[model samples]
Target: MSSHAPDQARVIPLRPVPTEPTEPTPKEPLWRDVVGDVLRRERLAQERTLKDVADSARISMPYLSELERGRKEASSEVLAAAAHALGLGLADLLALAHGRLAQPTRPARPLRSRIAPRPTETQSRPGDVRLAA
Candidate 1:
C-alpha cells in the first residue's frame, strides 16, 4: 500500500471582499435623459412637432429626434439651438433640467449617525476590549 498526502494544507492570503451596504443607494438619472426630457416637454407644451422644431433649430430631424429620445448626446451648440427653437435660452433649458434632477425619486432615508455604536451591556462578554470615548 502506498499513500501520499500533504502534511499541512496550504494557506493563501487575499484582499477582503467588499460588502454591500444594508440599504441599496438609488441610481441617479443620466444627464442626457434629464436634458432630453426637458426639451421634449417644452416642445410638447408649445404644441410643436419634432420636424418643426428641428427645422427651427437648423438641425436634422433625425438628430433632433435622437436627442429628444435620449439616444444621443448633443453638443453645447446643438443644445442651445434646440433651446432657441423651443423659445428657451440655454440657461432656461438647463434650469428646467436642474429642476427635474432636484426632484427626489425616492422617499427620504432616515438619518444615520456617523459614529459606530458601542456594544450594549448585554453584548459585552469576558475578554472583550472596551475603548473609552
Candidate 2:
C-alpha cells in the first residue's frame, strides 16, 4: 500500500507575507483647550514671553499666565488687547474664545395667553331656535 503523501514533500517556495505600513493616528481635537493652547503656542512661536505679552496687553502677568494655562476666562476687552499684542485681529481671538466657551442656551418656552370664552349660540343669535337635522 502506497501512502499518497507528496513523493518528496513537494517543495513549496514560502513567499514572505507583505505587511502594511503603519501611520501615526491623528490627535483628537481639543475643543475645551483650543483658545489657551493656541494663544500659548502663537506666543512661543513669536518668541514672546508671557511677561512681555502681558506688559504689551496692559494685563497682569499672573492673569495672562492663568489665561495661557486655560485656568482663567478673559473678558472681551482683555482678549482683544491680548490678540492685538500678539498681532492678531480681535475678531480672530474672539472666535477662538467662542469656540472654547460653552454657551448655556436653552430653547424658549412656548407662549400661552388666556382668551375670553365665546358666547353660546342662543346668546349670539337671539330669538332663533333651529330644529335638529
Candidate 3:
C-alpha cells in the first residue's frame, strides 16, 4: 500500500496559464508636447508670428521656436512672462503649465497658522521678547 494521503491530490487546485501574448499600452504624451501645442495655438489665435511673440516676450527667437516645437521645456518665470505678453494672467499661465505637467491632484490643506519671522529685530513689535545672544 502507498503511504501518500488520499485527500492530498484532490485538495489542491491547478492554476490556469495565460494563452495569449501580453502587449504594452502606448506611452502617454509628454508635458513638452502639450505645452508646445498650447503655445502654438495661442500664437496662431492672436495672429502673431513666432518672431513677433519672441520679440514681444523678450525671449530669443530660436529658444521660443524650440519651446513651441516641444524641443525645450520652459521654467515658470519664463512661462509667466510669455503668458503676460500673450495677455494672460500669471495664474492662468500656471494653470496651463500644470495641465502640461499633468501631475496627480493631492487634497488641499488649510492655511498655515504659523507666522513668518521678521528679517530685522526692529521689524518685531516693541512688546516681543529679545532672544539670548
RMSD to the true structure for each prediction, in A, is 10.1, 28.6, 21.9
**Candidate 3 ranges beyond 4 A from true positions:** 1-23, 96-133
Q: Candidate 1, residues 26-106: lDDT per residue as tens digits? A: 889899999998999999999999999999999999999899889999999999999999999999999999999999887
Expressed as tens digits, the lDDT of each residue in 1-133 for candidate 3 is 3344644331211333333443453466777777777787788899999889888889998988898888998997777777777888768765776776675444333323222332465444454444433
Cα-based lDDT at residue 50, candidate 2: 93
What TM-scores do the predictions have?
Answer: 0.68, 0.48, 0.54
Off by over 4 Å in 1: 1-21, 110-133
Pairwise lDDT winner, candidates 1 and 2: 1
Best by TM-score: 1
Order of the predicted models by TM-score, top scorer first: 1, 3, 2
Q: Mind giving the per-residue lDDT tens digits that candidate 2 earns over 1-133?
A: 3233534232222432223433454454454356777788779999998999999999998988888887877777887888999999888876766754544344333222222234455443443333433
Residue 41 of model 3: what lDDT? 78
TM-score, prediction 2: 0.48
Q: How many residue-pair clashes does candidate 2 contain?
A: 0
Worst 10 residues of 3 by lDDT: 9-18
